[model samples]
Target: MRVVIAKCSVDYAGRLNAHLPLATRLLMLKGDGSVLIHSDGGSYKPLNWMSPPCSVSDVEVEQDQADAGITEIWKVVHHKTADMLVINIHEIFSDASHELGVDPGLIKDGVEAHLQKLLAEHIETLGEGYQLVRREYFTAIGPVDILARDENGGHVAVELKRRGDIDGVEQLTRYLELMNRDPLLAPVQGVFAAQEIKPQARTLAEDRGIRCVVLDYDALRGMADHNALF
Candidate 1:
């Protein structure tokens, strides 16, 4: 990763138009060829970013640009989408690079953990004859949200998310890949369950032969009979 602190202005155009006026900002150039421009604040989100699968090239600045205090230009172009991002740089302050290595991964936040427990208690909500093998089943990569067996006795690996996004599906896919390697859990299936799932996520899950289940937190509780929650 390379980090550069410089006086720069950014312009992005594609789905929308955005501009960042001349200011000192932190620019990040990732090993994957992606670039991000960040301000001093705003948590972890950058002011502007070009995601991976893009190319970044240093374009020569015109004489007029140099006269206007612009010394360099960086142009980033997306491969598949053809999106573009241009940064006009005036002066450099600091530049450095470091190898951070692979991340350990993220953890569940908010009420997501509690929701997983509730789902385990009401495993039947998944479907008739669905039995919970265990919750937080251990795996080499990490814990699988819940491991179970469907009515047909096939191994079912489930991943629960508060808001199911593409990342949830990706996580489940990785788990399924690892579990299917075990002879005992061969032919494992995946199910993505969440309170709310994005349409794009559902489509991606379907494309990968994974099933999606939209969950109901309120339905986890019952009045007369506990099984009625299913």
Candidate 2:
């Protein structure tokens, strides 16, 4: 990981045009070829970012840029989308790189963990003709809660939560974005399932075309009672 604190201006050109005037900000370059520009605020969310399958290069600054107090130029380009994020540096406060090895990944809360297992076992509770493909469906970003096929054989990615919120919706959104890019799952859909869902989360999920499902823990466990009868 490379971290740099610098006074820079950012310009993004792709699906939309955006600009960040000159200011001191934190820049993170990860080994995965992703770049993020963050400010002192906004918590963990980056002000601007270029996801993986991208490249970053330090290019020579133009004469006019040099005259305008620009000391360096970094260009980040997405391989697939051809989107570009350019940063013009006026000065760098600090620059350092660290070798953080493999990560263990995220640990789910106990109830959340069980939710995934139960949802996978009773996959059809989502709807008739739903079939579970697998749990913890692997993607480059992270593991999706569950991957299944609908009646028409279309792929569906389910993200389970104990209490659905906006962050869960965003997480599912990222999964859908990455999964849909794969030729094998080009038309992947998403389901945000939880014991309770916030209105904001449901709104966001629906706006993104993701279906929301409220699970009944007791009912799900009731279905498991056949084992006791046996």
- The lDDT for every candidate, in the order shown, is 0.85, 0.89
Residues 27-108 of candidate 1: C-alpha lDDT, one tens digit per residue: 9998766688889986545787776567889999899999999999999997766779999999999999999897665567
> What are the candidates' C-alpha RMSDs?
11.2, 3.3
lDDT of 2 by residue, 1-230 (tens): 99999999999997667899999999999887878899999655678877778899999988998999999999999898788999999999999999999988779988888778888888999999999999888765578989999989999999999899999998998778667755567699999999999999999999999999999988887877754698
Estimate candidate 1's alpha-carbon lDDT, on a 0 to 1 scale. 0.85
Candidate with maximal TM-score: 2
Candidate 1 residue 193 C-alpha distance from true site, Å: 11
Tell me the lDDT of model 1 at 76: 94
